[model samples]
Target: MKKVILRTVFISLLIFSCKRKQVDIPIFSYSILNDSVKNFKLNVNEKEPIIHYEYFHQKDTIKRLFFKYNSDKDLLISNLDTFYFNKKTYNSKSLQFKFYQKKEINSHKRFLVFNKNYGLLANLAYGSDYLFLKDSISEMDKKLLFKALFYDLNKIETD
Candidate 1:
């Protein structure tokens, strides 16, 4: 009887240890505006977040995106939107642009998984307050959230 009880306790402990732990990561608020010029912003829940202008354009079904100045940082322009290149610079500053395209195999599946994991409400009634915990967000979502909002831009191809 004692051995049986010990086995039960061990199994319980193992199961508890394997459970997923919730974590609170900074949730980024994303937005786009159109007023004579198109603008985009992604900011954490903070004041005075750094602002940047990123571009995305699709040509012959091949999509590409670029930052005003090529930066390999935590934040990048989302490739989900359409951007038209303007021959103008920001603040009179010239930009050096490098571009990339998406290369994920099951992007649609990944996106659905992301929404499910994150509990993202697409059609929630406005002004609904909820406490959301960020945990186990998939690699695809993380890249989309931080790197680019599109898909695998890491895979390279050449003619």
Candidate 2:
């Protein structure tokens, strides 16, 4: 009986110790009018969170997003609301771009993922409330809240 009790306690301790822990890391995304740098830090992780970022590099200008599931393959631009990319620069200045598959509403702001794109987001200076508009790479930046919005994985190409 004594031996069995000791074994049970040891097993319990081992199982508890081996359990994975969840941590909360703050992130950010942005808008042009709000140029004051509010230090907005949204968090992401074990619990699902929306991760997003704006991209503006010569030709591949975009406002990217990642919904539910910790990680998922990046998607191609299914639709291009070219009202902002003024034929010269990849600028999204003052334009509240919208994103979704079957939902509605234009986005005012928001990168994403720690394991893969943490460095990039961090280099953008650690925040989702950011903007990166224009051909000049003014790098419009801001913070994005992880709200688990609407997304269609079927549209995204799998890796």
TM-score of each: 0.27, 0.27
lDDT score for candidate 2 against the true structure: 0.29
39-106 in candidate 1: lDDT tens per residue? 22211221123223222221222322222212233232343532222221111023232222223434
The TM-score between candidate 2 and the true structure equals: 0.27
Candidate 1 displacement at residue 83 in angstroms: 24
For model 1, the stretches where C-alpha displacement exceeds 4 angstroms are 34-156
lDDT by residue for model 2 (43-143), tens: 22322232333222222234333233223432212233211111111112333323322123255321221222331222111233233211222232122
Report every candidate's CA lDDT: 0.28, 0.29
